[model samples]
Target: MPDFITLTGARENNLKNVDLRIPKGRLTVFTGVSGSGKSSLVFDTIAVESQRQLNETYPSFVRNRLPRFERPHIESLTDLSPAVVVDQRPVGGHARSTVGTMTDIQAVLRVLFSRYGTPSAGPATAYSFNDPSGMCPECDGLGRTVRPDWDRILDPARSLAGGAVRFPPFAAGTWHGQTYTNTTRLDVHKPVGAFTAEERAFLLRGRGARVRVGNTGGSRDIDYEGLADRFERLYLKRDLSALSRRTRDLVREFLTDDVCPVCRGARLNAAALATRVCGLSLADCARMQVTDLIAVLRRIDDPVAAPVARAAVDGLERIEAIGLGYLSLDRETATLSGGEGQRLKTVRHLGSSLSGLTYVFDEPSAGLHPRDVGRLGELLLRLRDRGNTVLVVEHDPDLIALADHVVDMGPGAGAGGGHVVFEGTPGALAASGTLTGRCLRRRATVKRRVRRATGGLWVKGASLHNLREVTVEFPTGVLTAVTGVAGSGKSTLTGELTAAHPDAVIVDQSAIAVSGRSTPATHLGVMDAVRRLFARSTGTSPALFSFNSAGACGGCEGRGVIVTDLAFMDPVTTVCPDCAGRRFQDEVLRLTVRGASIADVLDMGPEQALDFFGDLDVPEDAVLRPLRALRDVGLTHLALGRPLSTLSGGERQRIKLATRLHRTGAVYVLDEPTTGLHLADVGALLALLDRLVDAGNTVVVVEHHLDVVRHADWVIDLGPGGGRDGGEVIFEGTPRQMLTVQGSATAEHLRRTTV
Candidate 1:
């Protein structure tokens, strides 16, 4: 077998014909600034080629059903193994999916309960909430009930004829509204508030009354349904996924969700809930923390249940080992953060006996505190020691230090990046003159002088989630760092802060919704100005410059690529034959703004675009504002036309911050602004936050990075631990003062990193 996996002449994305050999059966860390082609080389190129080649070995029938991996722009990849990519994308599952179901531990528990419970539940299926026999009939096993918000739906001050129905779909003058207005069951002229008790009941709850509704064509008698009943039937009784996103959002405005009364949020039928093992029901086991659950399972030594119990204990131990001991099996997968979801995905492979596979992790240390990062590092080493090649695209210094081999991908980002600036042991890279090396060698210190608070934003009695009715005050007009371990109440406290101050601007790490057609130009609201500029220069309609409109390439229909589905084969996507990959018609591409075509302009990085528009004398507040914001947020390397989906979590978060930069004297709440950022980039982010504060704004960030904590004017540390052990404020003071504080994990980590 070859000692290394070799790639010759790769040019994916910003890569410039890069070639390298990654050692097999060892841990290799890829390091670079954001958008410097680390992800392009590691994930888009190497992982894609490995998976694509592996997919070819399966039967054609099966291969066609699997996910299609497009061939990377690389020449000759050799000695590749089957690759498993654990990306930062959310572990998206329906409401029925939970930690137990996702990890398959719930299945074993179900079997144990079915066979050993005092009162048997027939079979394993009978213990499953997803199964009809075991499901809560009231909620269909979802554990939550959606009901109409009467206050949001009804305007009692107005009569039916005077627009009493607040829901847009049934507002006055609409067909649905006509039923209530024309019905003889209640007074149309009198205010709904003035109605008698019977009249109000009949208007809201009564049914089967005959009413006449008319359009210009004709009038006809129809059976009238009560307002509440009609709303429930049309919006609540059916699958909301089938509705358009806009419709679903509108419906949600008039609806609220709560625990189902029948299930009481357990999601199980009476028989299933009644079944217990060792005096604890299946739901009870699921609700216990993984760390606690392991002890519960270890006690079950009954010969018949031992194997299943052992299997569950093994899986639960892996979860606890990965520093997720606080998470319960019943926790909803949808509620997990990107980092939490990524770690959970890693858990399944930990128990696998498969060898000679390549495991690729995208920022495994992303959401972890410095203390937990060592645990993640150990996990990576374990994977490497199991005769598998482990590759990580990471920005954390600690994770990089754990690498047996390091490949630093840049001297700068975007057009300036792609070449291997340094490839050696971590010790050598630290001494080298590369950007990553300089960042590693530089020591961060706490702020010498902290800013005084202009006022206080108080969050009192914040008892949500894992919080313990804690009251805290966030100082206004200064930068505050909310530090905590994973599963702590930092997110919950931030939620309360935002709820208390609804006008605050929030820039979170949630993925930006994007499609093949979505780009930075569209997302930052600059596409219209760019289009208008092009149209005015050529004296054509603005639509003529839009790829989604008249200017769309006939061959690709604005997608820039033609996807061909082949029966029993991998679907292929190729650049359009008509307009190349410009996404616009030939004539549209011909139109230029100061010698640069629309496609050419979109292809420019933010810095390049800013320069191009600056030379054209575009108004600063109009087109230049957003471009400057992007550049200020350290995203100068990002191409305007690049799909938002292709960007990293840090880049996306920065993009969100850039869009909201114009606000002044406003409170800004940011969640993990440094996610996916290089060490050097964190400096830039800190500078930006300082600018926000200097310009008279209050900024509070939920972060785990010690540098952010060190630089913060005030630090609010939550948790000496996570979950139940970590809701109270352990320390609240300046970073310098936190160094002397005891028991805080954040404080300890901060002290360790301080020079």
Candidate 2:
């Protein structure tokens, strides 16, 4: 067997004639700023090849049903093992996918209750929330019920015939809206508030009352429920996250929140809930923070229940060890912060004994406080010591120190990045003076003297789960870093701050819109400007330049690709042969701006487009000015027309930042904006932050990048340790003062970087 996995002349994107051999069963970190070939080397080359080869083992029929993996270009490989890449992609599940189902520790909980409990249950099935046998009759398995926002439904002051309901799909005089007002069989001129109790109930909360309507479109039969009731049944409490932004907003306007009457938020039936080993229901155990849950499970004394419960306890312990004990089991998967979601996945693999496996992670220390970095390092080491190859694409110096070997990828990012500039032991790379090395060797102390806040937004007695009686004030102007290990209540704090400053234009990477039509252009609102430019280029109507409105190829209807779901076969998405993957008509493509077509303009990277459009006099609209500012924030490497789905997490965050730059009094709160950024881009990002402050905005960032933290006007460092060991603010000061204050994880990290 080969001693290592070998790659020969691999030419993945941005990778320059790369040849390297990674040692077996070691924690090898791919470093060298963002834009370096680290991700290309670890994820694109090694992990993809291993997964692709493993997929080839099945028969043709079976393979056809799986996600097709095209072979990566490479000469050969030796002693390769099946690879599992637990990337940081959001475990975005519906209301159904939860911690109880994800870790299967919930399965053990079911078994524990079924086997031994205060009251005998039917079987394991009797203890499952998903089981009809054990499920609450009212809410099915979901713990909440959606209701309509009644206030949005009717203008009680307006008369029935005077267009009282204003919501879309139920506009005044529309079939649905007119029926409610016209067929109360009451006078159309009377204000609703002056009507009898029966009229009031029928308008807002009564059950379906069949009625007849006559209008411009003619007569129609209508089953009329209160407008509020119908809206509630359709939108609230349901998982509407997948809908378009307009749909989400419209639904939100008409929806109200409610708890499930049957489940009472328990999400389980009486049999399952009653059967508990230690008087704690399965739901009760899951509701406990994983760390606290582990302690409860260890107290079980019954021999018959010991082994099964032990497995469940061990699983929960894994969660605590990886630094995610603050997360409650009943928490919505969709609501999890990205960094919390990533570590939650890592926690599952800690006790795993699987060997000869290749594990890939994206910035595991992201969103972590400096103190929590040590705990994250422990988990990564545990996986490596288990005889697995742990490959991480990272920027944190603390994690970098744990690597047995390090491969530095670039001198820059985008067009200027992707070359292998250095590779050796972590110690060697630290001394070699690469961008990463130079940064690692320097530290910026917090200013001994501090500026008085232009203003202060205070969160008082803010108790949002795990956060106990916390009160703090955030500076209203200038850059501030909320430094805490993952699950340190930073999100809770931000949530409180934004609520107090309702008009503060909140810019979070989490809330960035996701859709099939969304791209860097749409996300930054630059598509409108591009359309106008196209209209002027050929003197054609602007409709010809819009894919949503017109100018799409007839064959594919402007989708750029024909999507025919194979039903049984895995979905295949091939480039549209008719449009040649170009997405626009030939006539539309012929229109030129400065001798380049609109398609050509989109194809240009941000850097190249900067020079092209710099002198072309683009509009001063919200979109164009922000697009230019996006290019300024080191996004020049990104393509204007690139699909948002194609951008990495870091790229998406930066793109979100560019869009927020134009907002006045905007509170730009980014979560680890430095993720996937090259060391070269850090300076540019800092400049952008400075620009935002200068533009009369307040910027608060939840970050782990040392450079960003050291330069902050203020830092709130959380965690004396992680999970139960962590919670309160351990240190709060400027970066320089923070470094001298011993025992703070942030301080220790700043100290190392200084030396």
Candidate 3:
């Protein structure tokens, strides 16, 4: 077996024909600026090749069912092992997925309960909530049921013609609205408030009544379902996760969640719930934190339950060993922060008996406070000790210090970066004058002159989650940093602040759920103006300039590629032969504004597009305003037509921030705006936050980066510990004052970073 994994002629993304060899069974940390090809090299190149090769080893039929990965542009990769990529992507499963289930610990617990309970269930399956036999009859194991409010969904005061249905899907002129407006059963012009009982029944709960739709020549008779029935079929029964953000937001307005009345939020059925061990039901056991659950499992000494309980305890102890003892088995995996989720994922792998395999982590220290970062480093070393190669792409200096080998990959970002600048131990790299080296020892001083609060919002008796019943005031018109260890209730306190002040603009890491076709131009609402300008110039309708409309290429429609599905094999996607992937018809391509076609404009980056549009005879604010926002947020390098789905989490957050920058006198709540950012990019982010504060807006950032915390005019530190040990306000003052305070996790770490 080769001692190293080697890559030759790797040119994926901005990588400039790079060639390198990495030692096997060693901890290697890849460092670089954001967009400097770190991901392109680590994920798109190495991981893709490893997984693709492994997929090829399986039968064609099996490969077809597996996820399809696009082959990286690298020429050759040697000595690669099967790679397991644990990304920061939310462990998204249905609402039924919990921490225990995701980690497979719950399965062991189920077996233990089924075997040794006083009143036994039939089998392990019978104790599983995911199984139909164990699922709650009312909520179907979801633990909560969504109740749609009719009053919120309807406006009885308004007539059908006046848009009585308040929901977006059933609004006026929509197809669902037309179902009632064209019906002959009731008066379409009449207000619903004046309807008789029969009329109301016909309008809201009509049972397959025939309704006429469209003109007589093109008309068809359709079965008329009432709004309630249609809504249940259209929205309520569908998977909310798969829907667009806009549609999800619309659906959320009329829906409220309540605990299951039948099983009382215990996802298991009555039979499963009736089975108990040590007088505690399965639901009760799940509610206990992992630390407490360990004690409960230790008491169950029945021979049949012993082995099963041992496995459960082992997994639970592994999770607790990683500083996650505060998390409960019943906690939804979706609610866990990126840092917590990543740690939980690491705990899953710690039990793996396999050796000589490669483990890849993307920013394992992300969302972790400086204190917990040391624990993360220990976990990485543990993986290395298990005889696995641990490859991490990280920005945190603490993790970098633990690296057995360090590979630095840039002097800048984007086009200017990708060359391997240094390759050595962390100590040597620190001494070497690289950007990462300098930033490692750099210290940001506390503000000398703290900005006074214009006003304050008081959070009184706030006791959500791990947070104690605490009252605190968030000063307005200043940049405030909320620092805490993982699970220290920083999110809870800031969340309450946002809830109390609903008018504040929240820019969190929640996905920018636009359609796949949605681009920066479309999202910023600038495409309309561009289309109008082209239409006016060419003496055609504005629709002629839109690929989604009349001017689309007839062969591939608006999409640039033709996707061909090959059963039992990976699908093939080829460029559209008709338009050569331009996504526009010949006639539309012939028309141009300032000798540039619509396709040409879409290809331009934000900065380039702004310059091009400025030279043209177009409205200044119409094009420049939105383009400037992108530039202001350091997204000038992004192309106008780049898909939002392809952007990084940091990019998405910045784009969201760009949209809200113009709002004055509004508070801004940002949750880890530094995520996915390079150390160099953080300075730009701090400047952006300064602009917000200078604009007379209160800015509160929930961050773990020492740079962000030290730069803040005011600092609010939460936690003397995490979980049950955390949630109190340990320190609240300027960063300088915070350092002088004792026993604060944030202060302890801050003291180390400062000169």
Candidate 4:
């Protein structure tokens, strides 16, 4: 077998016809600034090509059912292996999907209980919540019941004639509302609150009465249905997804979720719940933290259950080894953070004995504490040691330091980037004249002078999630860093703080709504402004400049690409012939603002766009406001028309922060704003936070990067450890003061990073 996986003329995304040879069966860390084409090279080019080729090896029947991978824009790819990409995309499953089910540990536990439990469920399937025999009757194994929130749905202060029904569809003047308002069985002028107990029950639960609901057209006799019954029939009983987006959102506002009364959130039938081993039911085992579950599994001495127990323990230990021991098996996968979800995906592959495979990871260090990054590094090295080629697109210096080969791509970002500036060992790359190198060599010092709090926001007796009734105060008008290991209640505590202060603007790493047409211009709320600017210059309607509206290319309708479904074959996508991928009509393209068309402006980076508009004498605060905010977030190089779905996690996060910027005197709560950022970009982020503080905004950041903690005005460290061991504020002081504190994981890592 060849020792290298080679690629020549790889032009995927922003990559500049890149050529490289990555060593096989070794760890290669790809590093660069955000949007420097690191992901384009490692993920889009290498991984995509590898998976596409592997997909061809299977029969057409099998391949048709599998995920389709579009061939990347590359040439002469050679010696590729089957790839396993563990990306940062959230493990988004339904409410029934949990940690145990995701890891297959729940399946093993079921077998063990079926064989050795005191009162055994019929078979392994009988212990499975997804199985009809085992699932709870009330909640259908979902463990929770979503019911109508009567409080939100009804207005007690209003009479039937005055919009007693708070739901929009049932407002006073609507057809649905007429049934309640025009009915002679109830007093129309009486306030809902003033109604007698019988009247209230009749309003909410009465049925079988015929009522005349009329408008100017005519009166029709219809059977009167109770409000609760109507609501359940229309919204609750039916699949919420079947409703329109607006109706779904409205329905959600009037719905409340609670634990199932019959199963008490155990999600199992009585027979399954009765089955126990070591005096603990299968549900009990599923509820225990992974670390605790491992200990419990080790004590199972029954020969019949021993093998199953061992297999379960092995999987749980891998999860623990990856620094997620705090998570329970029953914990919903939907609630897992991006980092946790990525790690869980990694856990699935750790037990694989297959060799000669390419393991691809997209920033595995994201959402991890500095202390846990070392463990992640070890896992990568282990993958290499097991004779698999490990390719990682990373920014964490500690993780990069563990790489056998470092491939640094960039001299800049976007148009200015995509070249492989440095390729060598970690030590050599650090000394090289590259941005990644300079950042690695630079030393960050703790703030010498910290800002004093102008006021305080208190979270008192907060015990939500894993928090241990912890009370903490976040200082206002200062940049505060909330540092903790993953699952150490940092998010929970910050959540409570935001709950108390609802007006606080939260900028988090959660994904923005993205589609083929969703671009940086659209996301930053500047697309409309840009359209108006073009419209004013050309004396045309603003809609004429919008590809989503009047000016769309008739062939591709504004999408710029024509996707052709090939039935059993992989779907083919080609640039639209009419627009030539510009996504506008020829007439629209003919219109220009100072010699630049709308498409031309859309293609310009934020920095370039600002300059283009500035030369046109466009007001700075008009279209340029969001552009300035984008530039402030270190995304000046990002193209305005670039699809947001194509952006890296860090880039998306910065865009999110950019949208929420420029608001003064308001509390800004940011959850790991440094996620997906390059080391050099961290400096820009710190400066941005300082500006927010200087502008009289209270900035609280839940972060794990020591650099962010060091630059903070105040540090609130949570966790002696994660899960049950964490939650209390282990240290609360300036970064310098934290240097002397003991027993804090954040402080320990801080001391290590201090120059």
Candidate 5:
């Protein structure tokens, strides 16, 4: 067997014909700037190829049913193993998916209950909420039901044709929306408030009602469903969290999640609820926190339940060892943060007896508190000890310090990056004069004199989540850093603050919903100005320059690619032959401004756009302002026409921040702004925060990075520990003062980093 996995002339994405070798059965950490090809190399190249090749080994019948992956752009690979990618993406499951179900702990509990309960519930299937026999008929095992807020959905002040229905899918302009307006049942011209109770009922709750809907040629009679009935069928029946961000937002505005009155959130039938083990029902066990559950399992001294209890206790202990003791077995999997989700994924794999596999982690330290990161390091080491090759693409220096080998991949970002700068031990890589090395040792000084508060926003009693009823004051017109271990109520504190201060601009790492038509130009509101500029200069209709309109390629319409669907195989996407992926017609391409077509302008990066438009004497405020906002947020390398869907969570957060940069006197609440940033870029982020404060804005950041904590004017450190033991304000002062304090987790970590 080969000692290493070798890649010869690998050229995926930004990689410049790179050749490298990663040692097998050892832990190797890849370090680089964001977009410097670390993900391209680790995920796109290696993990994708491994999974694709593994999928091909099965029979043709099985292969056809599996997920199809396009072959990577890499030239050659050797000594590859079956790879398991444990990423930061939330453990996405339906509403029924809980911590127990996801980690297989619940499955074990179900079997134990079936066998040992005073009254047997048939089998394990009879104790499962996912099973028909055990599921509560009222709630369908979801334990909750959607109740539309009539006040939010209906505006009685307005008529049906005048946009009385506020929900997007049923709004005045939509096809379904037009159906209501064209109906003869209720007077469309009259206000909804003026209608009789029976008329209102017909419009809202009508089931078998018929209506005449307008068509292109004429009107046709169709069986019509009421708005409420249609909404329940389409949106409420599905998982709200799994929907697109836009749809979720719209649903949240009008829908209320209430506990089902019949089952009362137990999610089990009467028979399953009746079955008990040691005086505790299966429902009770599911509701208990993991730590609490361990105590319950330990007390099970029954001969039949002993072995089952032992297994449950062992699994629960492993979960607690990785610092996830705060999480309950009943907690929804969709509610877990990226950090919590990643840790849970690692916990699942730790119990596996499998060996010789490649375990790939993408920034496992992301969203983790510094104290918990030590535990994470130990977990990674355990994986390597179990006779597996562990590869981590990371930015945390602590994780990098624990590596047996290090491969530093860049000197810069975007076009300036991708080549391997150094490959050796962490100590050697540190002294090798590389970017990652210098950043590892970099120190940020605490502010000498803290800025005074112009005003204060006080939270009298914030007892959300794990947070105890604790009162704290946030000073306006200064930078405040909220530091804590994972599950220490930092998010709870910040979330409440944002809710109280509705005017505050919140920049978070939540995904930005995007369609195929959405791009940087359209998102930033710059495409219209650019189109007008082209029209005015070339003396043609502005529509002629728009690919969505007259300028679109006749063959592929506006879309640059032609998708050819292959049944039972991977679909092929080829660039349009007519316009050759330029998206515009040949006539539109011919009309150029200063030797560059509209397509060429869209392809330019934010920095390039600034320079190109500046030379053309375009107004900076009208055109360059939005472009400069992107560059200011450290997204200079992003193409103006690039799809928003392609960007990472960190990139999406920064993009949202750029839109609000022009505002003043606003409270800016940022959640982990340094999430995907390179070590070198931390200073740049500090400088930007400094600028925000100097401009008289109040900035509050929930961060784990010591560099960010060190530079803050004020620090509010939560937790002597995490979960129930945490949520108290352990330390509230400057970084320098925090260092002098004892017992606080943030202070202890900061003290070590500064030294």
Candidate 6:
């Protein structure tokens, strides 16, 4: 019989016509250094094909309404099963999406409340805050009402022609700016700062008036609304994420995200709240941390509430296992970090009884501390033992240790990496000579002298949810680590501190650039220097050196794609056959810079690009500094032209760090910078932290990597436990001091390092 999932001659992207057989009901890990085509094989080749084929099973009319997916280039397949990819992608960006809704716990609560309690509501529907009958009358279902900011719109100083509006989407020369100035009743040249009482009130109040924009020899009438009011209608009421970045920033400058006043964050209507079970509303249960809810569930012995409470407890236990007990069910799904999102998704699959199915996971241990990693491992193994085949693309040692089989892909990333170098049991793979094997078999000792702090920042009376009058001091001009298990109030404390100091540099793992054209070179500001070098070396105008300018290949129009979104068919992103993915005209490629073309320079890895800059006669600037910093952070394997889409989430975080290196006298915050890194790369990243502190900037890092924690001069360890049992800083000291703390998970792990 064929293997449960057989991959034969699988010549997908970067793959070398591979062939493999995987068992149907065991844990198998895809291990390698990052960018080793693990994702290309799992997500691109297998998951996409399964989902695309599943979509095809639907009627053509129905399939047309769904997301389009292109079949990957592969030769053969057998014994394929339907796949459910629970990835690190945020659950939903819709303002309504919350943990209660995503997990369906709120629906269960609605049922429980409708059947039981004091002042009983009508039906289950009547108990749903999301329903109009249950929604708060004031805030509607959204629970939050956005009011316009008058100061952002009505400038009282400069006139309309002087660009006093000062907003991104409504600049002076733009269509919206012209419309406001051309209003017949309003004086165009009047300094907005000097506006009369009526003019100020009318302009700020969003009074709609018919106004002429630029004349076509005749007035073209359009509705003139206040910029503040127009902005609210356009972006504030809707999901700002759907809009482009430029538009989002313009609205963000004036809008403040606030809790809904009517629902008071209950996110439900008053009528629904009238129904209660055991003197507790559904929203009250949801607001409790997972750990706290579990306690509540255990105490409820009522026969009427028993079954529902048991199910809720089971779901909450799954969350705690995935290391998310600190999160409330009411927390918005969109607010979760990628690691948190990934783990939260795993909870849905944890209780599944389906056997003989292949469950694929991407980096299950990503945001987890070493203490939590063991739990993640247990969950993965539990899935495998439940008679399902578990395939995980991971770098975490704890997760890898639980694998029944390990397939190590690599020798490199991108064009250089593809073939599986080793495939065997964990012991055999660890004994092998591959880079992953070598790194796993070895370990690093903490430095004897971790950097020292010259000063510190003190936090007082800081109580932001669960943080219970917490006071802490963060070392200045050194690398201080906030070591904690998940949901240990790290984010709340750090956020409060950052908010207090507006100048603090925050380098989060948010997307660097999403458009296909945005590559590492462009995002890092290296493109301009590269263009100037090409211009000077080739004796041509700088515009001619830019692929986005005169050098654009006409056949592809510099996009390198002929994207045709067929109404119901898959959107095809085929390479520009005319330009052969070069993105520049053939004539442009012929114009060499020194010895290589502009594309060749872009093709160089960050390490190689550093040397090129050193060799060039270009002016020394902040550009080269960050590029070198990126290389030092172990991104040397990455090419400058590699699309942002192709980058791993960890690489994106490092890129964010590279961007913030220019900031001086500013406190820098890094959240899990070592995530998705190989053991070898972790050492390099740790060294980069030292360099950061030596430069006179304060670095505050939230991390689960023990190696990072071991090297920290001052470690603020949160959690005697996670969730309700956590939020208090249980230990604070140097790494040396933490080693003797008996109850601390971080301390125990550091002790093992000494051995």
Instruction: List residue ranges in candidate 1 displaced over 4 A.
Output: 149-165, 169-246, 615-620
Residues 238-357 of candidate 4 have per-residue lDDT tens digits of 767556767888899999999999999999999999988999998899899889989999998877789989999999999999999999999999889999999999999999999889
Best by TM-score: 5
For candidate 4, what is the TM-score?
Answer: 0.92
Q: Which stretches of candidate 3 lie above 4 Å from their native place?
A: 154-165, 171-173, 178-209, 215-217, 514-516, 537-541, 550-564, 572-597, 615-621
Window of ten residues with lowest summed lDDT in model 6: 147-156
Worst 10 residues of 5 by lDDT: 645-654
User: For model 3, how does the per-residue alpha-carbon lDDT over 1-755 read when each residue is reduced to its tens digit?
Assistant: 88899999888767888888999989999998776678778888999889888988999878988987766777899999889887888887778899999899999988888788868878888988888989997898988989788788778888887888888778777767788888888887888888999998877778867876664367787899998888888887888878877787888889888998998988999899998888899999899888889998988787877888889999999888777888899899878877778888898999988888888999988888787788788988988898888899998888899999999988776566778888999999888888888877566676678888899988989999988997999999999999987778888999999899999899887767666688888888889999999998889999988889999999998887788877655557777999998889999999998899999998888888987888777776667878888888888667787778666567777888887776789999999999988787788899988998999899999999988888998998898878888889988999889889899888988888887
Superposition error at 614 for model 6 (Å): 3.2
Counted clashes in each candidate structure: 0, 12, 0, 0, 0, 10
**Model 2: residues >4 Å from true position, as ranges?**
8-20, 71-79, 155-161, 173-238, 261-263, 448-450, 514-517, 547-549, 553-581, 615-617, 664-666, 719-731, 740-743
| Pairs in steric clash, model 6 | 129-268, 134-269, 135-269, 136-269, 143-260, 155-192, 156-192, 156-193, 156-194, 157-193
Deviation (Å) of 470 in candidate 2 = 2.7
After superposition on all C-alphas, the RMSD of every candidate to the true structure, in Å, is 3.6, 4.0, 2.9, 3.6, 2.6, 3.0
lDDT of 6 at 605: 90
Clashes of 1: 0
Better candidate by TM-score, 1 or 6? 6
lDDT of each: 0.90, 0.74, 0.85, 0.90, 0.85, 0.78
RMSD of 5: 2.6
Error of 3 at 541 (Å): 4.4
Question: What's model 6's lDDT at 643?
Answer: 75
* TM-score result, candidate 6: 0.92
